[model samples]
Target: MRTLSPFHYIVFSPVLFLDKKQNSYYKKINNSVGNDAGSFAPLSFYNNQPAALPVPWDTMLQKGRDSVLARATNNSMGINNEYYNAHIKGKNGRIKAVDFEHNTELKDFRMLMKLIRAYEVDAYFVMQPLNPHYYTNLKDLNPVIDEVRKEIKGGRGERAYDCADFFVTDTARYDKALLTDVMHFSEYGWHLVNRAVMNHYALK
Candidate 1:
């Protein structure tokens, strides 16, 4: 229900963001979306240094992306060992595959569903744009997202009562080269997302 990203929004549109700041487009969405609507986590990708907050969102999502990357790099050598069955601390300190990287914290997508259920959300969507293409991309990660949805859905008992009832979608399946990194989209990526969002909203 929530997305944590290290991208800075300003990199995308200074004029739009500045206009949003003045007109409060984000605030309007925030006010309309209730607890059921879920939230965006600390989107540091939109701000930094002085690190002002991005508009229309509350709560930081994940730790700094750099910090996660650094930790993962340290474990890169260990990855080969795990692949070879020479695992270091296999069962002892297993980080879930839910994470984007080893250093990334395990975000319980199920827990998010629980909150959305509590809020009585009718529809839910989570958007995770490509981070680093070398790390993971939407086209290849659909199955993992599906698994997370199943786990978050829980069972059809009381737990099911806590799941988002109507619908939930995670849309990240875009092309690989669409991003230079998290925030700056490649020209094609930008056009793709632009068309996608417009189509989503029937904008043209």
Candidate 2:
């Protein structure tokens, strides 16, 4: 991984390493977000020129959040359809067969953890909730997760929280209301994640 700035905590999802194409696509998205930060800001015109004013940070953030939520809801069906096609009905549906065992993305993720450790940041890898249709053998993915946890722990002996297994323990019984798309969690789903994290860390 790339050089990382110091942070108190770093939370990420393993879904980021699912595939090369998707990984590259997300990197581009991250770059685009960085480039578009000005657009996300509440801007105003000063003498026919665009300028960022002293907008309330919370208000600007809420505006951006609302915009994204609106877009996501508006495109939910299409997004879910695409996920189904790619992960369930298409040739790539067999995710277990995908070369994630030794993927470059995994290497990058490990490097990221090492960098985080160098900064003494608390690193947490949240396992994303998979759609019930695509939910498969968790045991198969444990090796990768375990490696990540072990590397990050490195003598500190902290463990990565098993949120994925917690949510999917019942197998084939995911709550549809918790999902906007096949893979993307809805607000309620995020609430559950928040509670789980809080509980795990014994946060107030």
Candidate 3:
């Protein structure tokens, strides 16, 4: 599973191994811009500002949700926009259910936990909520989530929040208006997620 990439060694090797004296390339780039300005600000002149729009941001978001809802209602359970359309489709164009087994081999998750512990970083993990429109049953998802929750409980203690049922539990948020597609959420769903995060990490 070790995929090699030349970009990692070529880009990050100089910064990791060489000091300021040896690596002047980064230092020169850093010093090129003033204290108040960004180094790459000049390079991004064309795409710096947001395009002028007719409607307000809130209206734009509502329009986006409306579009998604229209598409979801017109299509078959939003499968046309869903990424699992081709992957999960079986004979007679019926969506097949998958069986998930408990897996404890979370090597990357352990490595990440070690890194956060070493750096003394306050990290929080959120198991993003799923749209029931895509997955009506949680029987298959439970085992995988159980394993992940076990790892997080053993590693990060209470720093993880399982919001996998956030949308499904509430019938109000379980609509296509809250979802951009089958997998991803819309602005409204993200706002709910933001509230959940704020509530979980609120100052004591």
Candidate 4:
């Protein structure tokens, strides 16, 4: 087992990992998109631009309360079938029925687990909070996470935390007050996740 330290701990969400081939595809689409506006490839909804300042409290609250924002965010991350289709296989507003043998992300994830074990690195795989109404199912992601746990020396328990389920335990957690878009979290939401991690590790 590895001890937790600044360099030893690697916390990440599996949903965001893209393989090398995917990167190449993104670049190709990006280049082609400029030449043709009606290109079939999914356009990137993620904004790489830096924020001018911290998000206001009112804006944070609006994330969950505003139907337009909620629909747009959910559609962009979920139903739009842009980026998700390339990496995952699912349909009808869902993206979590992962096929272990075919998923490149899971393959890379397993490789990452092997590296972590070889290097004795402590890591945590998180499933971030989702909108209750969102079609993506976090629980469907358990198979890969569970598979990787057996590879790590002591990977279960503190190593993974499904914040999506945590939010369900407390209604306050999923409320609009902690929302900052559907996929991202507000400051309070992050604080809750941090506290959960600390508690999982028995850290005071």
Least accurate stretch of 10 residues (summed lDDT) in model 4? Answer: 1-10
TM-score of candidate 3 versus the correct structure, residues matched by position: 0.43
- The number of the candidate with the highest lDDT is 2
Cα-lDDT of candidate 2: 0.45
lDDT score for residue 82 of model 4: 34
Give the poorly placed runs of model 3, Cα more than 4 Å off.
1-71, 75-105, 136-138, 155-175, 198-204
Candidate 3 per-residue lDDT, tens place, 92-134, comes to: 2212222332222344455555664554444455455544554
TM-score per candidate, chains pooled: 0.30, 0.43, 0.43, 0.39
| Whole-model lDDT per candidate | 0.35, 0.45, 0.44, 0.44
lDDT per residue for candidate 1 within 9-118, as digits (tens), equals: 21121011132233345555665776333453223223443644432211111222223333333232212222224433332221123334441222434455565566
**Residue ranges of candidate 1 with Cα displaced over 4 Å:** 1-108, 122-133, 136-146, 151-174, 182-184, 201-204
How many clashing pairs does model 1 include?
Answer: 11
Worst 10 residues of 1 by lDDT: 8-17
Error of 3 at 15 (Å): 24
Clashing pairs in 4: none
Ranking by lDDT: 2, 4, 3, 1
How many Å off is the CA of 52 in candidate 3?
A: 23
Candidate 4 similarity to native, TM-score: 0.39
Residue-by-residue lDDT tens digits, candidate 4, 18-131: 334454577677777685534535433233434455435455434434533343343433222333354324332334444677766657766776665454344445544444
Q: For each candidate, how many residue pairs have backbone atoms clashing (under 3 Å)?
A: 11, 0, 0, 0
Model 3: pairs clashing at backbone N, Cα or C within 3 Å = none
